[model samples]
Target chain A: MIRRKILFIGLLGSLFQIFLGCVPLTKTILSPGSPEDLTTCTNVFPVGPWESVHKIEAVITGGVSFSLLGVTRGDPNKRRLHSFLLTPEGFILFEGLLGEDGMTIQKAVSPFDSPAFAGGLMEDVKGLFLPPPGKPARWGRTADGTRVCLWEGPDGFETEFWEAKDQDRQILLRDDLGEVIKEVSLKGPFVNGLASYIELRASKPLPYKLKMTLLQISP
Target chain B: MEKTRMKRFLFFSIPIIISLLSAEAGSDQEWASLKEAAKNIRSVKSEFLQKRILPILTKPLRSEGRVFFQTPGSLRWEYLNPLRSVMLQKGDTIRLYHFSEGEWKPEMTQAVEVRRMVIAEISRWFQGRFDESKIFKNLYVPGPPVRILLTPKEGVDKFIRRIEIFPGTRPGVIERVEIEEPGGSRTSIEFRKTEINPNLPSEIFEKP
Candidate 1:
């Protein structure tokens, strides 16, 4: 009887371990990574007008969920931005400019202005969809099991790129303060794959989140 | 003595309980009637006071606007207060106008994916058919002011968690609409002086 009870307990322990292993974990932490180093990324073609739908959520300062439909074209040096607002029901509430140098938030559904709101957002999208302008200054491994690449730009912005073992591409951008001003992750660049889904969080107290999904990409 | 006191209390509460139950039933009936009334509305034209409350802000941003819709295909959403902007959908074309530019810019609405989605939505609204199956799961509740809560379908956009629409006791007027996003951003719009089928001009959609 003693041996039988022990075997039963061992079987139960194994079953519990199996169940725990099957449970999926949601990752909230944002890490830095590179585009070419990404294993699971869909091959993003560098060409004309592209559109995408993205699910956006943020929790650093506060929490909000919204989806954005984005359109972009032209080289990274000169890109045009346009976007539309939709309720989760797919109801079109408003249409606004995504990225224009002189955009004014004349009427926002939210209190934040367009430039301050879209500045960090557009930067994230550009990081994911557009290729890095120059080669990496340095490459190394992060303690968190991510491959990192540091890229320097003409402006005061420093971009760190990292890859997550066939999962997604992560990019961390910061200013001289070493504070992460923005972070982005792109999933799937397969043929006809989603363009690039991005999440952008600002360093300000009134930090905002922007999510972008690939709706359609024109060849 | 305790048993006698309990009997007396139960006897006194009977009438109050009956009245409360009757009031609840009446509220349910009223809500059903309102839903029935909404079914007959073919179109609506209303002037709305839209207030957008931003997080960490002292004042609610305000915009006064007018919305006109003709069933199945035509809609004109114009904002005239604080700033001037217009979105007009006529068959296949959508024109977005900004007062700052002082000119109407014709957008390639069909080719643009985002605009196509907008056009598709407006078209659906024209059909007088709410795609509840895809957009939202609705719940109706009773109160002095009726409340309709719309929870989005699963795997939808994250920007909006739920929306509350309160229709006034009177017909053809929506008292208020509250939109709650996942990030604590809320926007509310209140409508006043609403009219239905008021024979608005087609020129309202056509650029003058």
Candidate 2:
């Protein structure tokens, strides 16, 4: 009887640990290669503050779907227009504008006010358009031959930018543990190296994907 | 010369008079009865063009779609060009779908709750309950296709600068809805052709 109680306690401890482990995403293994020039690596990703209008159709799979007109501006890092979130039925969900003075939100309809969702949203948008924090720390290529550029951000986070041979660019924002918390992919029909398709995947906390298709790009 | 001028004036004036009379007929009916008239409408299907003009955008973003609505609660808002998405609502349940990664995927659960609110707002519009919200001041100008202008009150004024509604060719049918933003940008949804009280299958409300 005493042995059974001890085994039950051990099982409960394992379950609690598993629940805690689910907080972080599955760590992605990185392959090393020869260092390359940072400027040559980010040739495909859009830089500078320019407006991009896209038909944003967001789906959560078995939940609901909505298509709206989204306009994103600015470079990845600093102050930028971020992205304007709209609903298909002509309603403005929220207007996210990132200026030099942090970020400001207007017309946010309820859910965006939450600390978790709003923070996650801002991170994803910044991950997709803006450049990583600080400068490029290193450059290399993955085992899949996808060119990788790593930028060491504050608090020991590594933002990696990957580019395929075919001008397709992918961004992986990972923490110190090598867990890719966020992944952004910019893909083809490159018009002067600007991607027509972009997808952002958030892996930690709550996993969600935002896919944006370009309708028009203005320099 | 005087007779010819009088004759021309009469010709234009008669059509104007007739249009005013028809508009008066619409306005003379009680607003509640018009709400009842809206309930009389069984189903509606119309093709629409959505033009989103913003100050940041160099050109207006144009999209095409179809809008479907049924009395007592059902709506299918589908967009075809540029992007494909469908928002369907039947009674209390609302389902939305988008073409993602070449497959139809649903949207976030938050949108479902939002849709419920939107569906309620749309239902109020369908019932012709102009006084439903204190946020808008509804106006009407007499004509063959009467004009209903809705100007939003204070807090809501920033987002929805103005809303203009026009009656359809069919009596008591809605023709167009135009929403303008504060910065001269607007989203104009023009119903090219509209079908009123048509028999739409239940599958029409299902995700396609």
Q: Rate the local accuracy (lDDT) of all candidates.
A: 0.50, 0.64
Residue-by-residue lDDT tens digits, candidate 2, A94-197: 66777677777754554665766666667676666666655576665546666667778778777777677776777777777767777777888876445788
Question: What is the per-candidate TM-score for chain B?
Answer: 0.68, 0.74
Candidate 2 global lDDT: 0.64
| Model 2 misplaced stretches (Cα beyond 4 Å) | A1-36, A55-69, A75-79, A140-146, B1-42, B72-74, B81-83, B89-114, B120-135, B143-145, B153-156, B183-185, B206-208
Off by over 4 Å in 1: A1-219, B1-32, B91-95, B107-133, B206-208
Model 2 chain B scores worst on lDDT over the 10 consecutive residues at B9-18
Scanning candidate 1 chain B in windows of ten residues, the lowest lDDT window is: B10-19
Candidate 1 lDDT over A1-219, as tens digits, reads: 999999999999999744522221111233444555443222332444544444333333433222322333324334444443433222333334434363323223332334555554444445655555556655545556656566666775667665666756666676655456665655665434343555555555456555554444444
Shift in Å, residue A183, candidate 2: 2.8
What is the per-residue lDDT of model 2 for residues B80-186, given as tens digits with 9 covering 90 to 100? 87777777888878877766667877766334454545455555565576667444556565554466666654444444555667767565577777666665657
Q: Indicate the residue-level lDDT of B103 in model 1.
A: 49
Q: What does the interface RMSD come to for each candidate?
A: 19.3, 11.5
